[model samples]
Target: MMEAPCKRRRGDDDEDAGDRDRLNALPDSLLREVMSHMKARQVVQTCVLARRWRNLWRSMPCLDVDQDEFTTAGVSVVYSDHEGWERFEDFMDTLLCPGNVSIALLDTLRLHASSMGEDRRASRWIRRGIKYPHAGQEPGLQRGAPSCSSWRLRRLHLSNLYLCNLLAEHVRSRCPSLEDLELESCTCEFPAIASRSLKNLVLKRCALKGFREITSPPTEEPVYQWWL
Candidate 1:
């Protein structure tokens, strides 16, 4: 072999294959934790890293979506174009669909939309966040109230959105696990907000021109408090 100048074997001194996959080798929980600190777009982009990470972001315990991530233009332009809004909605649906979310671990959902056009889309996304899929339920069912039996939502933050009385009522009645709710610069005509599990409510710069009152749970602990 020496006389013939033998060729070096490819693996003669190679590092372990696993060494090159350090990030992928991390535990799924740790990986998710890392992804949690990133925006929804960044989290979704990790799918391209490797086959193992393709669906890892789907199980993220927290979701943070902001319209500003897509564009810097005014809300009017962002929502006026049919194709632009459609793409935005589609992207959100893909990320926030009930099937993609990990219900048991989901704790925080933050949706921020700057314009009225995105309000409805934000509302629909919020509903899907708390929605539970029932057995035999048709896939992609767009009608009817969202099932909240499996809701584990604890913290929600909505900004620059329009909400109806029914949506507020549903959140108060259906999401028993909800503890903190923050509505910033929102437009709502709700008469009242009543939640037994709510602890901290923040209404900063919210337009409650049609509001009537804010009622807390019957508990004497005064666990619920509102901040304006």
Candidate 2:
């Protein structure tokens, strides 16, 4: 007896079903190595992709954002879009946390939000993002005065965030693990950054009138320091 010939599936028929699932997923470490090549803006856009690729961004652990990218995301302070304000909040809610977070999770979060001072709250959050790039599921975290958490921060990038003695002091007291800190283009300054582990530090264009160094309890030396 002759049997009927078997038929192969069409390319579109097979592909339409679903993307081939990876049986043996690549190790997170290796996968991050590949994500390192992408810029922060590109990483943010990947959220719309499949869930597997959703969190693949935070794995970079190092976030780099330029001025233009900030503007495009509607995070620029110099510009204003009544509608963008609402959209920005919605956008932030989605980027709360990237599960694969680590201490060095976000080494640099360069936020170039302009110096717009109309809405204090929105400006503050923009500044916080640059200082801390770790993503989470929760949003609406407050900053300014006591924003410093017990977490270890490797680098902080802040611009145009006005601060008072209370906020400045809070960071100096809380960020125990901060290694590199930048207060560029902001009009605020910490009371004093007394961290012995601080290697690279910058305080530029800020009202650091009260900024100082904690020398009375000072013991070790700072690898790198700067004030401008």
Candidate 3:
């Protein structure tokens, strides 16, 4: 005798259901907090877990968008091929687009694209991170307007990207609330980086041939370790 095929238990089914729904039972604020610790792509991928998590990532306060996150499998292709750069740009655009992000709650935006020839795209993403709606209109109403009032953007970090003078100026003028800035292995042709609100600045292995002035009030001396 095969022991009557071992009847299924109702308690087992109940336990399974409870386990599946445990994450969904968490509050939205907690969920967003958890998403904030994750990479931008990992946060986006959580949408597939269930319908309740579909838009949870959009509410996250921090976005860490690095091309290296997507190049885990194809290092050489991502670093040397045009199509790889395009794919990275497209993925970043999808996350940084106004429609996909909750701009008012955003606190930090970090981008790392080691590939060359992506300066324009990097600048555009930086601009988007600093933009918000005007005062008298609904959110997302205005495009390319100063949004110091609506955003909480405090920390910005860029790595392995080229920064032009005009783009650097735009960053200084538009992101008035920026507190901490980090540039690593970047080529910046800007004459100056003057920010009234910036407190902490970090530059590592950066090319600053065009840099002439940094007008931030003296805080802790900026970390300026550059490798040739």
Candidate 4:
């Protein structure tokens, strides 16, 4: 009982082909580009796909976080179920925690904070995302340490969250490259809106109390629709 050499060779070749990892073979930049199109949750979940993908999401340039994703069949489980809210908060904490996301590479952050039923927690996460002296900065003032002004966040959209007065301060001092800002259905406590680099501002169905001025150079008068 002897096996044929040609058949054995063919079988070995098939196995070798199966062992090849085509997805991993692609360039990291290309893979990340493809990941940019997916939701932030899906991108983070890709870590379970393979070892190489585990840390790939840390450098993602864009993230879109929607609280609705935690819902089940058009009903928000986050507000109804305690465990669900905890899970959502945990996910947000992990995603925005220090040393988790490479802030240097982050370009855009879109947060849909509706249906969370936790305004304080959601507001904290927003602050973490746009804080000036972020956790990603170099530890001390070294010779060639990267400047704190290297923030690359260009566009920020906050939906259905409570924003404090410090938000304006953060935009003016911390985010040097922020150009577009949109706030929808948010209760803003800021007294004024001011930013040097901000070009486009949109406030939709947002509740503003004692909001007096807009310091930014006139830009279409800020598209305010359905102000609350």
Candidate 5:
């Protein structure tokens, strides 16, 4: 005689149904906000969850593309395998492409790589995304300053990188919406940085030799936090 069909557990069925229903009920904006806090890879993986999530990442307002995320699950960043580096590059190229993300609403971008400047591919990809439209010539970011800028960039955080002397000028002239700037363990060559829109400046363990001061709005001095 054939065995009776196994019955599904009521609790398990309800729990699964509730999860799907709750996720599906959330508005796109709220979902996108939730996605902002997740890793770039995880965010992209959500596309396979359902039809509604297929294109949500394309308009995500904030993106954190950290190279550390590409490493092996339990490996330290220092001993990361190079195998995932190429994948990381490919992911960045696809994500940064003009049609991939809504550049108009992109206000925050945090790129964390162990040696970003040394890796030409990483720099090129960054330039490509930062350029947004033009993709031919190598911009000044490689040489010194970033020639291309985004009008919507409000917060910029640089860590363990060499910043150029013209960075201040570029921000003042190009990045009109910039408000927060943070540099950690970075080598800055700029003597002074002045921006009418900058509201917060934080420097931690940065090497400041000739660097003199930061010029910001007089109504209220930009909150300055420095750690030697």
Candidate 6:
């Protein structure tokens, strides 16, 4: 028997019901929780799966971006010279605060992209890392600004990143709510990233060029802490 003639596919709204069905069919929210834990690129690939998985990602909470995870995910990275910093740039563009997001349970932001800051591939990630939100604000950030203010962010971490001169000045004031903090193999130039409310903090192999911030021990105390 011949198949019926093809018709135009419905818009994403039509598919949203299907997405809800898939979300409903799940035994629990485990899938959503898992998706929340993965990188933005991994989440984008999931969007191509079906309407159900597509819409589900938008509601996810946790957002984590780092060189190792991006390298593992194999996104469209353009790095052959800055060491190994190519991968994370692709994600940093998609997941910044200005991006339209209804719910963002940002718990931890970490950067652990090897110690060779001058590596051609790695340096690009550092640049993108420094230049996100302001430079790569999705072009549509103006429309997304309302949603951007409601992000439920908790922790922000940076390791092995080389902050640009301009961004380095503003990093501290931008993400002050973060509690658990760690910096390793990073360069926070003069007038460094500061926070009045940090709980557990660690710094390892950092590079400071005649600039530093005084980090007072957590008065509230932490459950666990370690540094090298």
Predicted model with the maximum lDDT: 4
How many residue pairs collide in each prediction?
Answer: 0, 6, 0, 0, 0, 15
Query: Which 10 residues in a row give candidate 6 its minimum summed lDDT?
Result: 143-152
Scored by TM-score, the top model is 4
TM-score of each: 0.72, 0.59, 0.76, 0.77, 0.76, 0.56
Q: Give the residue spans of candidate 3 off by over 4 A.
A: 1-16, 72-77, 102-105, 128-151, 218-228
**How many clashing residue pairs are found in candidate 4?**
0
Which rank order by lDDT, best down to worst?
4, 3, 5, 1, 2, 6
- lDDT by residue (tens digit), candidate 2, 1-228: 999897766876667555443422667566666565666567777657667767666445555543334444544443564454445445444444344333223444554445345235545554453355444312442221223354445677766666555444444655566676787666654455555456666767666666666422255555544555
* Candidate 2's TM-score: 0.59
- Model 4 worst lDDT window (10 residues): 137-146
Q: Write the per-residue lDDT of candidate 4 for residues 1-228, one digit (tens) a residue.
A: 987675466588777767656667888889888988888889999999888888778777678888766655544445675555666778888876776674444678788875536765788875665553356433441223234545677888888888888788777777777788889988889898777777778888888988888777554354433455
Q: Summarize candidate 5's per-residue lDDT along 64-181 as a digit string, tens digits.
A: 7777777656555543556667667677777766556533345676666665444534545544444453232223312122334544668877666566665566667667778888
**TM-score, structure 1 vs. true:** 0.72
Poorest 10 consecutive residues by lDDT, candidate 3: 133-142
Evaluate all candidate structures by whole-model CA lDDT and list the values in order.
Answer: 0.68, 0.52, 0.70, 0.72, 0.69, 0.51
Which digits, one per residue and each the tens of the lDDT, describe model 3 over residues 1-228? 656778779899999899888877889888888888888888899989888888777667678887766564555665566666777788877775655774445678787886756665676665554454222223544333344544566887888877777556755666677788888888888898887678777888888976887877575454444455
Which ranges in model 1 have alpha carbons more than 4 Å from their true place?
1-20, 72-86, 102-105, 129-150, 218-228
Per-residue lDDT of model 1, residues 1-228, tens digit only: 348778877785465554656765789889988888888888889889788988777767678877667764555675565555566677777765545654334677787876666676567655554454232133553323235364557888889888778667766766777788889888877888877788787887887867876666767243433455
Residue pairs in collision within model 3: none
Worst 10 residues of 5 by lDDT: 136-145
lDDT of 5: 0.69
What is the C-alpha lDDT profile of model 6 across 68-117, one tens digit per residue?
A: 65443344443333333444554544554344332233444444564354
Model 4 Cα displacement at 35 (Å)? Answer: 1.5
**Candidate scoring better on TM-score of 1 and 3:** 3
Better of 1 and 2 by TM-score: 1
